[model samples]
Target: MLKEKGLLGNIGVQVVIAMCVGTLVGAMMGHSASMFAPLGSIFIHLIKMLVIPLVAVAIISGAAGLGSSHSAGKVGFATLGFFGFTSAVAVALALFMGEVFQPGMGVDLTGVEGLFSNVYADKGDLPSFWATVLGMIPTNVFQSLNEANILQILVFCLFFGIALSKLEKDRRDPLINGVNAIVDAMVWMINVVMKIAPLGVFGLMADAVGTFGFSALMVVFKLFLVYVGAILIYGFVFYPLMIKVFSKTSPVKFLSVMKKPQAVALSTASSMATLPVTMEACEEELGVKNSTASFVLPLGATINMSGNAIYYGLVAIFFAQMFNIDLGMSAYLAIIVTSTLGAVGQAGVPGPSFLVVAVLLSAGIPIEGLPLLFALDRIFDMIRTALNITGDAACAVIINDMVSKDPSHAAEEKVQNA
Candidate 1:
């Protein structure tokens, strides 16, 4: 269908061109590029307006669909398992690459002393396990919705959906149908907002590059390059391999269809913002079932942070090597566990990455140098956000196959009857 729209009409191509042009404009205009910031801000706000309600309704519809079939618990477990396992693997891979490449060795921190500060020291103190658990249970769900508290919203919606599924069909079907309609309307709204994506992308990039020029990046250029390489290895090599081995879907076709969502992810740098596009690609293009896409994708976007995990792991190792701290087995273990879990705990929104402070502090690495990377986080965030959504789609495709094989699911029942 996108092919029928011609090259100029392809959002992916338009986004790529916008990114290039924006970079050029920013490089030339410097701080004057701030003039375009409003364009990007407006686009992001429009997308955010729909994300909360869309995620809330879609999760309800999906959970109700699966819960009625008695497969909700199984699918939930499978989804979490995939997200947790892949995230751990991503951190491990980043650690391995960091150790092998030694991106922080032979580095010069000569003039970056002013960038160092201890403001983020308190961030490393993560909340207690029980505190984290309690935080997910919103006392007033309406307040949670108003605050756009995604994790709490997810918890409430899932519970509501399960309860709804227990009702008789006479009562349940109408609410489910209504929720589905809301999800459809949300998608339509997302489609309308996406029309100006190229202009929004251009503004976002131009402001980012102009505000944080590549000057600081030169100091960490090696780390940047290695980080990109690791991302490519995971995105191009690992995800495709998993899809080819486990799912019936063609990995080549999966990659091809994913370009649209990936482009949006690249520009927005917020998986929550990119979610509607990701959902459309999974259901409409990649043939992921609507029920699976609705549940797994929202959950994945919330908890699945393989890309962020990699960043944490690598950054920990980078700082360690830079400081010449000889990390023992205990330190590596701390980095792995903290990076994986911290990444999962992170919110899927765009902003400074404070979670990295936790990873660094967990392993006794310094947090003072974090500002060096903070300035460049936007560039890094854009790239990894793309990979993050790709992981979401990969899991959806695999889980779709898994659900289709379970005879208790409605889709599988239909196939069996056919």
Candidate 2:
């Protein structure tokens, strides 16, 4: 859509300009830059509006539509396990990278010391294991949607979707169709929102730089490098190796088919919103079985976030260091578990993936460091979303290969059968 229509037509160029302008203008505007916060907030609100519904319907349709597959249970359980394994490893890698690099070591936090003092006042306390598990099931689905509690929505969708799948074909078709329509409508809305993304980034950058000054930017930049480096290692090295080792499929062919989904994910910074395109590529481009693509990709989008896992690890460590907190071996290990689990429920938005919850749910890490982390969130969200998509595709590829003895012929038969 952003073809050669002149200066305003190119989003990449616009974002670059906005980043530069935001930093320069924010520095010049100083305290007065607070005025631009609302603009950024508007953009976030636009993106947020789509996340819950998009995820709900995407999950419902993807899971519910797996009715005709013979090994739905096997495929389903395998998919979930793959996600858990990959996410655990991703967080571990992040912890290692963060500990080695020390992204926030000696960074000044005094500038934003007071910014997050009250951000989590009511719910800042970390809940116990029982409370955390209970909270996952929303008391009311309507209320969960209103609050944008992703974990709750994911729980509801999983149950509701499986129920839909068990119904007679005629009984389930209408509900699935309705949900699919809503998902499509949401994707359309995302396209509209993305047209104005550069403006949103500008306002967010302005508020961030204006509030914390450039030193925080440097800290965030270092954190950004750590994240990007981890994503590269995971996406390029880890993911392809898994595909090659576990699957008979060519990584080159897999990535070639995945090119569109990866691009869409990076630009939108939302795996949930990019579901349709990703699924299409999986079935049509990659020749993955419908059973594998339907079950694996949807679950992966919500819970199997390699990128979020990495970010969670780094952010936890960075926050701990910023507050002069020393982490014991137990604290470090807890972060690995916390981040892996926390990532399971993290909404695929551009910034701050359940930051409040990660801080509240996990051990260690002061709340005061949130402002610095939030500043560069959008900066990191893109690459991580791409990594997130890569993981999803990898999961599908491996699962498809595992279930099929003859990958090519079986994929074709599954497609025809589906």
In the range 285-389, model 2's lDDT, one tens digit per residue, is 677876567667777877778788888787777777666778888887787777777777676666656544454336656665566666676667877888898
Residues 166-225, candidate 1, lDDT per residue (tens digit)? Answer: 899899989999998887777777667777878888888888777666676676788888
**lDDT for position 267 in model 1:** 66
Off-target runs (Cα >4 Å) in candidate 2 are: 1-17, 33-38, 106-126, 256-259, 319-326, 353-367, 405-418
Backbone clash pairs for candidate 1 read none
lDDT of 1: 0.84
Candidate 1 residue 195 C-alpha distance from true site, Å = 2.5
Which candidate has the top score in TM-score?
Answer: 1
Candidate 2 overall Cα lDDT vs. reference?
0.74
TM, every model: 0.92, 0.82
